[model samples]
Target: MITLAEAREAYRGYAPTYDLLFGPLLQRARRRAIRAANDRPGQRVLEIGVGTGLSLPYYRPDVRLVGIDVSAEMLAKAEARARRCGLAERCQFQLMSAEAMAFADDSFDLVVALFVASTVQDLGRFGAEIGRVCRPQGRIMLVNHFSTPAGLSARLDRQLSRFAGSLGFEPYFPLDRFLAETGLRVTASAPAGLFGRLRLIEAGKG
Candidate 1:
């Protein structure tokens, strides 16, 4: 399991070059995630593990956006990006954990967690926190590069699992297991990234 400490340390190092390294390569998937949100005007949206806020500009200016991240260094960049993108008025950044968000029940209309499921220490807690903050019937979107079930890639991922802790993410987390652990009512899934290796899972809260 990837601990909060490990994730913070890993992202601290990635903060400076995060946009450069992940920006273009992951841009397509990021776009897919934002589009899937289908946010409306005046809606409150929560983005967990918002990273450098590369997806901030894509959100509608009319929507209220709150982005939370565990890493201070990354959040600083995200805040700076929000300012640069002129999103400061509609966007808010906070240093928060996905497992324990600082929000009231049913606080948001939508929650987006892109590339975050594999990084958290406990999927169940993360999912529970998400469900609690989201209004009943609210939407949740998660985009991640999940490993295949039975393939050469799956074996390679298992072998790499030993090193995943240090890397700050699990390489072998399955889609079905995530649903079971999170207890989310998934509605649809769309292909993202190259060869559909990245998945955008859309769900609803009860």
Candidate 2:
């Protein structure tokens, strides 16, 4: 498991080139996740692992947005992005952790966590926290790469997992295990991103 400190360190180094390295590759899924969030006017939306605020512009300009991340380095870049993009009218930032957010209960109508599930040290707490913050019948959306059920792809996931600490995210996250551990019930799921390697998931709090 990748520790929070390790992930922080990794992102500190990644912050410099993050947009250039991951921007294009992951942009499509980011757009898809934001679109699927379906935010309405005045709804409060919380985006965990907001990283560099690359997903900020994708959200509806009318909805209220709050972004949080554990890595200060990335959050710094994100803050700059938010300023440059004039997203302050619609969004705010906080340096916080996904596992232990400071927000009050039912604080958000929509919660989105993109490419962050496998990067945290504890998925159970990660799951519980998001669930706790979302009001009853609110929505939760996740965009991640979960391992295949079985086959060559599964084996490849296992092999790639060995470098997870360095990679800063596990490559072998299983969908069933994630659902069971996080206790997040899928309202709908669909393939997204390049070659369908990424997953776009929507769940309801109720």
Tell me, by TM-score, which candidate is best: 1
- Candidate 2 on 138-200: residue-level lDDT in tens? 899999988888889889999998888888899898988889888887889999866767889
* Number of clashes found in candidate 1: 0
Score every model by TM-score: 0.96, 0.95
Count of clashes, each model:
0, 0
What is the lDDT of every predicted structure here?
0.89, 0.88
TM-score of 2: 0.95
**lDDT per residue (tens digit) for residues 72-122 in model 1:** 999999999999988898888899999998899999999999899999999
Clashing pairs in 1: none
Cα lDDT, model 1, residue 171? 91
Poorest 10 consecutive residues of model 1 by lDDT?
32-41
